[model samples]
Target: MVIGPRQDRRPTMNDVAARAQVGLRTVSRYVNGMTNINPEMAERIRSAIEELGYRRNLAAASIRPGQTSGVIGLVIGDLANPYWAALARSVESVAAETGLLLTIASSEEDGARHDWVVERLLQQQVDMIIDVAPRTVGRSWSHWSPPLPPVVFVDRPGDLAGADTVLADNRGGTRDAVAALLAGGARRIAFVGDDRALHTMDERYEGYLLAHAQHGVVVDPTLVFETSHSSGQAVDLVARLLREGRADALFAANNRAAVGALLAFRTVGTRLPIIGFDDFEAAPLFDPPLSVVAQDVEAMGRAAVRAGLDRLQGDDGPARVQVLPTTLQLRGSERP
Candidate 1:
């Protein structure tokens, strides 16, 4: 439909400007979420749009030749998991400040689903994507062609060449947590994790190994268990491990694994010494309290968005792999 004054059509930006007593450009800038609009002018535009019941043509704006969609796509591993949920919230906060909408999708921690998620995001033609999902097995980004949109990865880094990534000190944090367990006389520590395919899990496992090597404790290969990121699976694995009678303590590579381990404790009536990878709000409130190596997820989220925005602003420099630090929170659980 041609956009003009029409009695039988919905309200348009032109109608909004007329009602607000402002220039069309001013109304356009305000409606498009430009940050420079004067407060008084913004109020008038807001009131006029509300009163006129004006709805923006977001589809047209997204496809405009010389403008951005002002939207960012975010694909995380699993939205139900607290860790990814918290990270997405942080990304949303940052996106809001830039007047950009954040569209979040979950890959369900499956590689095939991850491929589909990225493809869907690309089809939406978002300005950029913040990838917090587990990368597909082998080389990631093979599903998408070159000249892709600006992409920023978090946690596990993306395999796309020259893609910016924000990573926590996974190896170091795991090593520290494991070493502390060792120092507390906890040997035969059962190492539990999600799919070994995840880069974050690989890093955490390496840290677990490093701690054992540093302490001169021989690592039993049989003690390591790889399972999906689920508490129920963890309960089964932990129960079996407990039945075998080899586990002295437990080191969970990620929050899901940690949750699984905790659930297993309840099932088997045995609370093995455990040090988890992520920190939750109720961790300290647990019966024995929880110990964990906490990643600065909020910072990682902020950095990922900042890098993507920079790339959008024509930053063509070599992709920077930013590594943020983690903190070891020692409650009573790590001691077993």
Candidate 2:
């Protein structure tokens, strides 16, 4: 029997196609994760594939004509967070223009998870990397570089040591928001944000301090709240502040923390003026509409992808820290 490896060559797509009585194109599409496979035929093809021990040579398939130029790997802190999700969508859209597939992985704000995700993407030979909200990798990223792909930081700014970055105008926008609040008669404003170790968080905090100094408003260190970037912790801290009567206005540093503080305020039935860093859904629908420093999240994503593609095309463009502008929108929450 021609059963040993020496006698029987490994099963290929052709063998599976022959066994399933399906066209080569049908089997090809199934293996490539493409759609349009009927349920019954898909089941039959899968069974035949298993029976024949057929495995796709992904490396070979990746370089086929009209096939993917490998994947554009995106690593973000959290997919549930709207900023990262919007960024991922934008990256996918831009990558589509270059005929590259997008593979997104969420680190959930953990440094180890971020490292693992990037390593896995590297193993798969992604064409490029985009990291949004990376924690500890910023300083040492240059030391651990990928062989073929270049890494780009998105949303959260970092000194990636030669890596490109796309970030929102965090400091200027926060200062503007604080100025608006001061003008609205909000004297007792409290700052709530993530750990100061984060680059964007630190920048936003600096803006807040700068605004306070400019307006001759004293920074009451007692009113500043810092959490470990936890949604529940943000909610708890905001709720505690409301109970203690420390703040008449709140400035949320990031979107998730902002949403959590909003939820806490709603639960407490407080209508204190609130301005969030990132605009979110249903902000206008709340009893008191929310004021926010809104970044062009989609644009940031597209810019990151564009930068990566440009580098991939052998462009000797200067490595830039592209900071998109942020807008402060007036809402009922900031009106009074």
Candidate 3:
């Protein structure tokens, strides 16, 4: 038989994972000094290591040490946005309760910047991290693994194994809201929001599609627009949709989208029933009182902090994902 790549090359963690018949994460955990693994699984990993002559860097820094820096790093998207600012405020409150300081960084929705901020936080030796979201949760943080500190993801679910995540019931809330709006009488509701690359937007978009599926109504694909994450982008897209006269109602994915929709409608001197996700400070003051699917920003912050604390306090359990509920606050919009 021809020589296999494994036979000619230095064994790696990937090789160990295959030989041990376990996930790469399990192999990683055993090699990276996390001792909470099952004993049988541990033996398999150990056996693989010995057979492969794989050398573990005895001096490699563990993901986290027994000591803490009394600081919790917070990485969010666009701190200037009211929703994000509110989340940061709530996180600070929980951090203060535990005699910890918060180190905040705005990713500006940039993947490179998000990675840079994470590296800088590691250099500063923050106790742990709580990130709102980065580019794409499933693959964004794949670069940092073994030595990365514990992270609790908020606003979206992260793909990291054993990491805690706190999020709103995005799909469920949107489904309920859209279903209710449909039950009322509005058809041809347009979905306007951020790009689908974002996990939150993807979930909400799914909710939008599911609602249509439930109603047995075919969605006009043209009515769905995934614009850039900006007020200007939303305004332009919504204005174009308005000119087309293709929508009877609007479903805004987030607060900024909602604001843009309102502004666009005002400019045209026309109105449609609008239901948006995320509540802003001025929603109550709107002429017709904006309706929304409101997520508990404070609760999300608290849950993320709690999970981070648990990880620091020797809780080696599996990752805890908390999905808080959302309420449909109907004022005068989204009603037939």
TM-score of each: 0.85, 0.79, 0.78
- Which of 1 and 3 is ahead in TM-score? 1
Q: TM-score winner among the candidates?
A: 1
What TM value does model 2 have? 0.79
lDDT of 3 by residue, 25-66 (tens): 999889867999999999988988888888764223323465
How high is the lDDT of residue 206 in model 3?
A: 94
Better of 2 and 3 by TM-score: 2
- Which prediction has the highest lDDT against the true structure? 1
- Compared with the true structure, model 3 gives a TM-score of 0.78
Give the count of colliding residue pairs in each prediction: 0, 0, 0
Instruction: List ranges where model 1 is wrong by over 4 Å.
Output: 1-8, 12-55, 135-147
Q: Rate the local accuracy (lDDT) of all candidates.
A: 0.86, 0.80, 0.84
Q: Candidate 1 has which clashing residue pairs, if any?
A: none
Q: Is candidate 1 or candidate 2 better by lDDT?
A: 1
User: How many clashing residue pairs are found in candidate 2?
Assistant: 0
Candidate 1 global CA lDDT score: 0.86
Taking the tens digit of each residue's C-alpha lDDT, what string does model 2 give over 122-161? 6777788898756655334554654547678887765566
